[model samples]
Target: MTALPGPVSPPPRLLMGPGPISAYPSVLRAMSSELVGQYDPFMTATMTETQELYRQVWGTANEATLLVDGTSRAGIEAALISLIRPGDRVLVPVFGRFGHLLAEIAERALGEVHTIEVPWGQVFPVSAIEEAVVRVKPHLLALVQGDTSTTMLQPLEDIGALCARHGVLFYSDATASLGGNPFEADAWGLDAATAGLQKCLSGPSGSAPVTLSERAVEVIGGRRRIEAGIREEGDEDAPDFIRSNYFDLGMILDYWGPRRLNHHTEATSMLYGARECARLMLIEGRDAVMARHRLHGEAMLAGVQGLGLVVFGDVAHKMTNVVAVEIPEGVDGDAARSAMLADFGIEIGTSFGPLHGRVWRIGTMGYNARKDAVLTTLACLEAVLRRHGASVPSGGGVDAALDVYAGAGA
Candidate 1:
């Protein structure tokens, strides 16, 4: 007889990895809210509210702030495809995997992509990026603000000014850093920026929150096209319309803007979750949330170093949400990771490309960036290390973390 599977259930896990960390409890509840018809007045109101909330989150006055109904990468694709016409020159500075991803996406958009690279564990200096910008004379500068692969946060403060000076449009993928780290889209002079809710926003990865400045809007507006079935009497489609229908930001903006033109039926549940994520961020106050992440992040750093683990990357420029620790000699990295899941129910992460199997990435972000979470992970990690025959100091991790909290009067 064929047996049917039961209701799905996942094991309890402390997600202390680079992303997709444990979501905030309220966000989970928000997703389960009952749905409404896509064009229902209530649904539209919620959509408008979500847009306004994300404006505060992105620190932008741009009217194009809204959600892209997919993961973080969807936002990146939408921005790139909409902004880059075929044969447009695009410059990307590669410091990690995601920078390479930006370049690849640009290539697919029929762009003439040029990339300047630094080593895996480092970030490019603003001068080097400017030098590339001067040479390439690109139409757009695409960059990744916080790349988890190398645990590096590229400094964007000056890069935007460099782009402005060069008359190049600036875009950044802030998926891994947005909520937990400090990001000011308007203040930083970013023409466009995108992020997902999964990382520091404490929500599942489905909806992507995006914002665009007036300059970006003007560029995308030139490529607007209404589909055949949706064409109205006065509608005029551009000759060089955006290539991908799903990723056309112009059409998306019309749908999300005052026109409220229907593009596709919105993802209702994901919208609810995304709204709650931004609501929580605003209610807690941005400065307070940033400080919380910083506090917990420092504690985790102190804890890991106290265990005598050598951290990878330039610590000074590391993102406040995640850190990369070198795998001790004689330790089977994959085996230890498996044991952490099997024995302790904690999930850290493995590196990619050059750092694969060489370092473990530990994250202190979102809901899991609490004092208890940090201490528990450090204690369990110390136990796991001892069981794997690695010499570890007794109570070293926890004590060090506690000292950090105590000194901060937390």
Candidate 2:
């Protein structure tokens, strides 16, 4: 093989896809700050600060909050594996592909899984989950707050009350909804909630932020273990071992606890990035950042409609970041997307699982959730469609989006 080139560089482009929305400049700058070893005092302090930032973002006072050293799925695994023992029952209310993923992971953790699926493009009512819980009497009730696969937001406000009344631990994967939608961890009675920075947080996707309520913490601690490496020979009997070594929430908590036991080497750059992402949102105020995403999403929806594309999903229940658009006939979805990236330097996404080839998912999230980014994406999309033999009114989509932005005046 030929020797590698001196240095590799990447072509920069506007990211307007379903996830990995463009990161804020501050987030990037934070990642470039000086690096330190995992146990270094400054590094550990930074980790503490990062946890505090996410706690504010999550609107929770739970003391077991910390970042998983992997993506959103890592957080999900940690929550499931630590809480779900063999033969324990878990009830999953599925609305999209990621819901299936939750069930799969819980099953691997040896849960006796039960599922009730709403239609692909719809979410269940609180009564539905409550009814299922009553019938199934499961130990845990798991769902996703917003499933980007369908571009639909699952309403959790009332579900929490039902779970609390029924005595089932509530868990949710808020990977796609955390910042774009209003989420209150404690108020909603969420026992465990996890998310990644790739979506509305506007950071790289490596680290996952997670929090657990006191009740959930008690359940997880039931299976905790004293690490042999640190335990004295005469110490009290060790706590029961968690199912998976790597996903042991107890061990992770210890690493982030007062004792500072060693876990995986945290992703330092990602920690910096995640910290700054939360910092920026905190500075903007959570409600304001959510409003910005909402306005941009409305403008994008209007622009897509002006371009003669049909918007998908239940409009009233959709999230403020991603929009699902119906693909028109006689045009190749993959080809148009490739053209958008290659010619216009804009990235859009197609659906996953069942919705594949039937819809195009365009997102206005995080740092890209702005008027300029929204209008530019609309303009480029119009150009790509026209060049690819689809009909479009000249300056139609862009002008429509501009009108919305102009009216909103931000």
Candidate 3:
């Protein structure tokens, strides 16, 4: 028989990657809280409170904000599968890997998908998306607010108003941008937005926080259907039922709403963690958290540049949470990344598709977004680069980062 694995003792790692980074300690403590009955009064009350906290996080007054018991991708599927009906024209602006993910999910929903592509490192201009909207006349425009693959933040401020003008529903996957960056769900006129706790929320990847505008709620409401075993006398299922049962937002909303309808058993510990993540964000103030991320992000960017590393993508459009730097010409990117992990216990990221083996992604967000974290990552990265025979100036990385903190008086 194979030997049983010993009690799970994973090696300590500083996740400076694009995602699945270090979760906040308070969040981990909350996740360890004892479980309770799903329908218990305390559980229901906590659920309601979590909803309220997320409203502040999303900057929305939408009544349908809630947690989906899965990763951020699950939240995206829930929104896409529920809102997009068969043959509905959906326009997707593809900038990076996540944009393709959105288009793929929409296709699985049987929507007539149309796409407008920009180069991997860039984002679509609002005028370009508006042109697509006019031509495709899509029922929904799905986009990603931040694509970590390229570390680019797509401008959403103008796109939402453009969608509204075109009478098109708008959805954005904000998994990588929400807490660390500025997101105004209501002010931006977004119909739906989804994010996971693992990124900017500084929590584990089990819960996805999602918010739907009233208009989005109405669209999802039209597709509601109670499962046969849970059906009530007055409940009416829709003729155009959502294709996916698990991803049906309408049923999920019912579970979170005042009716207290039973759906899946709540992931109790995850709910606790999710609540704490939101609670901490609200306590710090959203703008303050974004500022912290920005400060550290700038430091990291300066640090890498000072090490003579070429930064990837359009710097102006890069996300405040993550930055991608081109791998040196002669150094093996994967080997360098592995050395950083094994030697320093720091984990950076590799890019995807067109950027694969071309760039290394480093992140400064959530619990890891701090001056110390930025300085340490830069210091160790310089060591690793030098060991790999890449020319790196001594103290260049850390000094550049320190100068940034000094300039910010942080």
Candidate 4:
């Protein structure tokens, strides 16, 4: 056996990249609190409080709001697998990489997946999605609210109404956009929505918060199957059992609901972090947190432009948390990113798929969405660009960002 090094002490990094962004200190502290039994009064009370807090964050009255025990994709899979039966037609509008991921997960669930596409850096219009829905006549419309890969925020306001008009169940993956952008689950008529704590919620990427409307709950509940070990006498399983037991939302609902059926032991520390994330967002006011993201995100955007770098995608429809910029001519994108990390102790991200190697994605989100973080990143980026023989105006980046902050009265 190879002997490993002693106790772990990692290098400190200012994570200014797409995600997972730096988590709030309060969230970290919450995770270190004392543990309790799953059904202990304190534990159950904390769970209930977390649900209520997320209700405010999602802007919904969904009684089914709770956290999934894994990463953001776990929530996505749970929602999709439980909602989509075999041979059901699911329509996905692909604008970015995550859209493709949604379609793939649906296919694995035995849903007949149909997809409509736009370019990587653009989003689908309501009319385009409506046109596809009319043609495909799908049972569910699975879409992404914000895809960090493209830095585009698909406008969901009218899409839900259009789906309702056509009898299509609406679901969205809001993992990258939730707290940093405006999302109204009930008002928007979303049957199901899922998000994670890593992005704008300022926590580690372990737990996924999910909310389901009454209709969505009804569909999933119809497939409920009590685990054999926990099944009581006379309990019956559905004819079409959910293929993946861990991702079964029906059984998960029973566990989270008043019945408190045992499915798996709740991840207690992650639950604490998730609860703290929602609590901090609610304490600050959801709109206020989103406005902060916008303020800092705009600063980062203006700063990059001042450095003579072109921004990617349609600016008007971009999310308020992250921005992608074209890699400068005569500069090695990877080398510059490496220097930014190795020398400056800061981190930024490179894009994927079509945008890969051509663009760098920087984020102003979560606890790092602040004037200092934005300005510091721009300052380091300017140094890296200049060292790489790219011509950049002296103090231009910081100046432009300051101008934005000044305009915002920050």
Candidate 5:
């Protein structure tokens, strides 16, 4: 066997890809701070502080707000498995791949899932969803707010109110949109919402912060914790049964509640990162952060178009942070992406479903949502495309991006 290297350093890549966006320097510093016992005074205080920080990020007053010690998918799983019963019907609007993941998780938790779908790269109309809710009369309705797979952002304003009128418990996964797009969990009538720190949150991808409404809490309360060793002695107040232990939201709530029961060991470093992510957003103010994302994202979009690549999607309904560009004929999209990463140390993404080879997804999110980052990405991308024999309009992409940046400042 060949001898392996002891350690390695990673190449610096500008992550203009789908997620795990460039991490904040301050967030990394917070993660590197000295560790303490999970329940230590300082640790607990920080944990409580993290919760408060997320409350502002989520714009909700729900008492069940807390972090799942895993990725954004963990938060989605917790919400789905907890709310879904053995035979309950769940309505999921399948607009993109992530929406299908929600239905899959709910089905795994024994939910009878019904789906209403549109073509990929498109969102379902509110009337379509309302029709499904009226037909299925589901116990819960799940949607993905911004799907990176298709670079489509669903309009939630009217859909949330429609769900309320239908008496359906509404939930959304805002992983791709939170912080970079407009989201008001409480005001939006969201029953439960979950998001990861990977996207516009500008943190590492371990912790998933979530919030749930009072009605969501009540729906979850019907099921409580089921202890392993104490199976013989069932509680008189307990429901018939509970689902998987690791994904149990009831036990998680209690642990995060006043009782503070022990669940999984809290990921200390990740908690620090999550807290800093929200703290920075709050310090900058949400509107200002959103504006920054908007400006940078638009610059990147303009730069890509200036490079002669056609933009994808209904431009009017596109999200602020990520843009999809159509792959030019005779150019291998994967080759361009590989050269960008291997040669230039810049990463972009490809689309999903019907758009697998048709478009590339580029993002300007979080720490990378800036003038320099946008210019750098465009410059590097232009070089990569030129190397593949594509005629790059000289100085076009970078010039357009710079113009957008300067105009925004002016």
Candidate 6:
């Protein structure tokens, strides 16, 4: 038999891309700690603490706050599939790629999906969404809080009230904006919200933190079913069982709750990483972390513009975590990106769909959302663009970013 490869080792990289940014050191350390049994006291305590910490992160008092043992999309699916029944109407407002993902998941969940679209770079106004909700009269409104593809942040302040007025359940995927942007689940009246440990949370992407309101919990609890192996004599099943047993939130909740029923074996290491991510965020204070993102995000924006680059989309509605800039003429976009990665060990992102090949996405988020990271990316980008014969003023990018930091008293 052929011998296996040696122990794993990854190349060093300064991840300045849109997501999967560098995780915080504490989170990594937490993940490397010893493992415990699923229902052990230490393991359960860690889980409970994680839920409470995420409650602060999500700005909710939800008792159902917990982690889904998968990526951010898994959390999105769990929330949608549990809340939606066959033939129940769901309204989705699409602004970018993730919106389409939500719609597709809803359709798979047997929801009568209705979608309203705006151009990729724009977000829907309160009036427009309300108009659709009133006309469609959907049972649920599934939307993305922040779409990294277009770097647009849909405002939820008014949409929540609109959903309540029309008796529609409100749900949002906050995977990209949860830690770095301002998101108040309780104040925004969100019935359900889901997020990931990656992006602004400054951790890896396996676990997803989810919060559900009392109304949403009631809806899901109505469809609860006990697993056959663990079912008691008094257990009763709903007529229409949740389509996917693995994605069922009802049974998952029982495992998280006092009953401590066994479902799938909890992903213990991921839970530790997720817990540490939330703990660090709560320690730093949510508003402060958001302010930090704003500071560095603005620096990156100003720096790119100083390099004679034009930014894409409506800047007024841009998220504080990522920015998309137009690729200049006479520059081979792919070649410049390759040079940046190969020469500088730095990684930036490329756009998708209509914006693909037209723009480059620069992210200031998570562990990389800092003045040094932004300045380094800007300096390297300027060098890369200059090498490609693009007209970039010498020292312009770094100077402009420094000015922003100076103005912010950083």
**Candidate 2 lDDT tens digits, 123-175:** 89877888899999998998999999999999998877898888899999999
After superposition, which runs of candidate 5 have C-alpha atoms over 4 Å from their true positions? Answer: 1-4, 225-241
Error of 4 at 271 (Å): 0.4
**Candidate 3 lDDT, 58-144, residue by residue in tens:** 999999999999999999999999998778899999999999999999999889999999998898888899889999999999999
**Candidate 1, 115-227: lDDT as tens digits:** 99999889989889989999999999999999999999999998888899989999999999998888999999999999999899989999999999999998777545332
Give me the runs in candidate 2 sitting further than 4 Å from their true place: 225-241
Cα lDDT of model 4 by residue, 1-410, tens digit? 99988997879999999899899998999999999999999998898999999999999999999999999999999999989877789999999999999999999988999999999888888889989999999999999999999999999999889989999999999999999999999999999999999999989999999999999997776545332333444544323547888999888888889999999999999999999999999889998999999999999999999999999999999999999999988899999999999999999999999998999999999999999999999999999999999999999999999999999998
The collision pairs in model 4 are none
For model 3 the TM-score comes to 0.96
At residue 377, give the lDDT of candidate 3: 96
RMSD of 1: 3.0
- Residue 360 accuracy (lDDT) in model 4: 96
Cα distance off (Å), candidate 2, residue 243: 2.0
RMSD of each predicted structure? 3.0, 3.4, 3.0, 3.1, 2.9, 3.0
Which segments of candidate 6 are over 4 A away from where they belong? 225-241
Q: Is candidate 2 or candidate 3 better by TM-score?
A: 3
Better of 4 and 5 by lDDT: 4
Q: Please report, in order, the local distance difference test score of every candidate based on alpha carbons.
A: 0.92, 0.89, 0.92, 0.93, 0.88, 0.91
Error of 4 at 337 (Å): 0.3
| TM-score of each candidate structure, all chains considered together | 0.96, 0.95, 0.96, 0.96, 0.94, 0.96
Q: How far is candidate 6 from the true structure (C-alpha RMSD, Å)?
A: 3.0
